[model samples]
Target chain A: MNLSRTKIGAILAAPTVVYMVIFFVVPSLILFSYSFWSSESYRVVPDFVFTNYLDSLHSAVFWKVTINAVRIGLTTAAISLVLAVPVGYYLVYVSRSQTMLYLILITWFSSYLVRIYAWRTLLGTNGVLNAVLLQLGIVDHPVDAFLFSSFAVTITLVHIYLPFCILLVTSSLSEIKPDLIDAARDLGTSSLGAFFRVIAPNAANGLAGAFMLTFILVAGDYVTPQMLGGSSGQTTGLLIADQFRKTGNWPLGAAQAFVMFVISIALYFILVSLGRATGLIVKRRTINPKGI
Target chain B: MRKIWSTEDILQLHLSRRVFLGGATALAGGVALGPFLPGSAHAAGGDLQIMAWEGWELSDELADWRTKNGVNVEVSAIGNQDDVTSKFSSGNPPPFDAAEYNQGYSDLYIDVLKITKPLDKAKIPNYSKENLFDVFYDKPTWYRDGKLHGVPYAWGLNALVYAPDKVEKPASYTDLLKPEFKGKIAIVDDTLATWPLAATLAGFGSKFPHLTKDEMASTFENLVKYRDQARVISLTYGDAVSLMVSGEVVAVLIGWTGIPVETAKQGLKTEYTIPKEGATTWCDAWFMPPSVDNEETSYKFINEAISPEIQAKVVTRNAAGVVSSKAVELLPPETKALFDYSDVNGIFKAAPLLGIPPLKSAEHATYADWVAAWNEFKAG
Candidate 1:
């Protein structure tokens, strides 16, 4: 007898189930456990100690850095999402040329290190940006601010996540029925009105998805802050790294990571609730004259 | 289900000679490939790889001794002795077979019982009475219960470096810490190094690492004053040198070993000083580790390194440090003028090797605090 469909489904899903268990679920649980313990020399004690948690919460610096991390994450998500929406729509709908869209996406395929390094060269003290400004007589001296500002970090993050946002929004836009556009046009709606009312609502889910992913990536990154933030760029992530590496204090690092994880989870849930509320209001629209 | 064979099944199929031959061949190949992989028995050697100050690499004469003795030796050359210590503390087993202790510092807790095994002088003939001077040789800190544990390697004074054109005639070590030269100066970020210079300038070096609360307060005041003018507290000797060379920063406190040579070669008209207040000098010595398997070869390497030919080579490669009794004769006259052995005026040396407190164990927090304090200082 042939294997049942349910059995086949289980067989196909076995790889994913194993994947999550081995890489995601297990490591996170282990890391969670480590956060509760103390390390005296290099030796780790398994006892639960809340001192690390207390230290992170009590310090004004921790709070300051956490707020900065949130600001960075949200700013990155907003910029990447806003910039991606237009590009993705244009690629999927406005442009009929397959070669152009493919050419556009090919840009994202380069290594991230190469992109960051290029940006570094451009913004460096004696870099292209400064050189150009000097030539134009825009400023008297080389601009160290371009490389070592919070602005560089936000710009770089937006650049890194823009492709992801486009990929997400493009896929969502692809899911919209072509007939819906035709139906809206048949009802005498303008192309812009149809897009804002119909296509955007369908793609709201993708926008939320992109925001969620980008926020996590931006919040956890330490290198961008270190390289671009200068002395002022001391982020919570860099502090967490310091605790583990130089301080040889694993418990403290783990605790800080745990707090960050908790904050990220809370933000995710808050965004989800807000999205649900907005999505409900959008789905209630009765503007369509002849609903099927 | 497909059938799987266990050990019992394999034994039961012992009649298959072709399969047995294939298994035997595979096992032999694995054995042959073993030595080529990391952590293999043959890859495990008795030779200990040492990362050390530039003075420790090789003597010009000992290239013959090393080749003839059929012993493998690998040396990683570095500028500052503290850098070698930093690597050892950074996990992944200690870096080398043996490191030279900062002269007279063989007794420090970091080196003594923890990293190095004490030496028996009877085994190594080159460790004679005359080579190590009275200041280092007579130090009981280098000896445990009156036995020499390490062979004195190379020692030098770290001094004030300034561009002659800019500074004119700066007097004492105190001149570098002044506000007028602030942003125009570079300093080695030793965390505690400025303590000797700062303390001495603040009238407290004689009470180093042991100070009355009042003295500590004065030192802190001086440090806060010094901190005001500095642009950046660069963390490495290389960084200090770079900032100085690029003219982004002109004068720096630097290790005498490699940098003064660079200063001379650049024709920068820079001066390295020993102030009237007195200076600190330090020496590094070769130490034996308990892990050393062939003491005979190790002893030979040590003895050959200190002999006149190699000592002279060490001096040549390292501009300031004197590795052996005869190393002074090898130096060019101008380089000799830059640093002197007898002068303690402007040069600040390494702390005495032994009997000092091990630098605070959980000192990373101290660094973090410094960064925070520095940021506040800069903001102000």
Candidate 2:
């Protein structure tokens, strides 16, 4: 018997589709349903109510933490991508050895908590950074601002996610042939101009995907921020986690999570639109049948 | 031999492979579900399962007792009070024979959720009026409805932890706000531990853990002052210890008694003091859930938990107060110096073990409200 390409593709994807439906889609739907419920005395009651969402919206603390999370997320993503693109370019276009990439991947073997604590030791008042500054007479005393601030949170996040972002960027750039960059340069485009005019627009979708993935991880991270962000580092993820862990208000936590999820989707769209508007992303043109 | 196999031979091979796969899958499923089966250890009361704080497992302390009793014990470390509550309330609850609940959470576990049942004091030989300190005996938190619901095991204080080298012993909580302590203080983000101190600072020490809405607001308003002085809001007791050890802050406002012990391990000397505004205290007790399977083993475990030898070991390791009066004689010099065993009643009067805010209240603030207030303070 003969089968169409689409049919073959569907058959190949069936297992993954079923797995996702069972594991992801069903759990997500249940969590979504829980957002509409209410809680009293640590017990979640099954009832349709919008009080959780409305209360979160009206609360000043909620807005404050949400905005703080967004700021940290966007800043970390921007820094990670900016730093990743150069290393990714070197690995894809300039280097033939896979050693550097292997080294980058090797960093993941270390525990995440260990990395966070390492950053704490490096940025603490009497840390290596302060010791160096003091030796060089950069300042009279250690800078307290080096840690337990939004800056510390963002810097630590950038370090943690940079390798991941670099891998994503390299994978995206590899799909664009180095020959395309050479051709652009031959047409009188400088190295920087070639990167912008030829490579970026072609790899726009992949780049945006990498940024959004990093942003979502950073924004939803409660642990790093709690460890480094101090009072200013309070984020929506921590608040939602507290609702479930401390307050036993699962429904309210679910509502806040869904709200953050919706915001993340909106941010993704906004980023894609901005890329197109700024000509960083090229639009595809279709041929008219009448003209043809 | 380069011989072509017949169709029947191929079909027979496929049938054998299918049978092997089916049998393996069934075996795996049975192994995974064995614990929940009726004849399994969990159901047959052959093993005792406990949910408790990390150190409360008493694996090292109870080794001999467990061996003598020929009992297999399983312990699950809990991150917070709600862990046990969430586990028991879930659709398929674990068969937890025993669990630990803080003093304040007894009401929620016993009265509201009904997750716990009255303990059979007759079975626990070590849990008695003569063995336990008078302060922990016949308490309203654990003893309710004319029945003992929990056995008091360990207790601790939430006071101001300070580095003696950098700062002198603060005479009052207000000293934390002095110019000398600027950028040298940390307030822990613990609502339950902070509430009593906040109440004291708000001039409502006598009515703590049960405050009207206006009083709750005043309590947090005072907490905000401490927050302003704090260089950072430590997320946990460990975080507070890290801050103190690193010398990032000279003092921790509303810190744990265990913080000094933790920091001392890192070569940092820190001490805690109950200021004029007083401090908050917590007592942990062992209780059996209603779904307990091995009641006999569970009672033995709870009784052994407060035994003099076991209590001494636990108090030393945890840097906490022991409920067993006899345990004091077995404590080491440094462990004995942690708390004044001679004046157990005086220590209770200085910082009483307070309850969590009422779960539901019309004229007063509830636990949920206190959580929200704590979150707001942390956000700032």
Please tell me which predicted candidate would have the highest DockQ against the true structure.
2
Report the lDDT tens digits of candidate 2 across residue range A113-206.
8999899999999999999999999989999898998888999999899999999999999989989998998899999999988989988888
What's the DockQ of model 1? 0.09
**Lowest lDDT 10-residue stretch of candidate 2 chain B:** B37-46
Candidate 2: where are CA atoms >4 Å away? A284-292, B1-47, B70-72
lDDT (C-alpha) at residue A24 in model 1 = 92
What's the lDDT for candidate 2?
0.87
Candidates in order have lDDT scores of 0.64, 0.87
**Could you give me the TM-score of model 1 versus the true structure?**
0.66
State how far residue A205 of model 1 sits from its true place (Å): 6.0
| Candidate 1: docking tier | incorrect
Residue B115 shift from truth in candidate 2, angstroms: 2.0
Provide the lowest-lDDT 10-residue window in model 2 chain A: A283-292
The TM-scores of chain A alone, one per candidate, are 0.86, 0.94
Model 2 misses residue B213 by how many Å? 1.8
- Give one digit per residue, the lDDT tens place, for model 2 in B1-380: 79698999899889989999999998898799876776443222258889888877999898887787688989899866767777876656578999998988888888877878898787788988889999888888898889999899899878888999888899998999899898789887666787787888888889987899899998888878888888888767787888888888999888877888888899999998888777777899998887788887888788889999999998899899999998899999988987788999998887777788987889889888888888888888
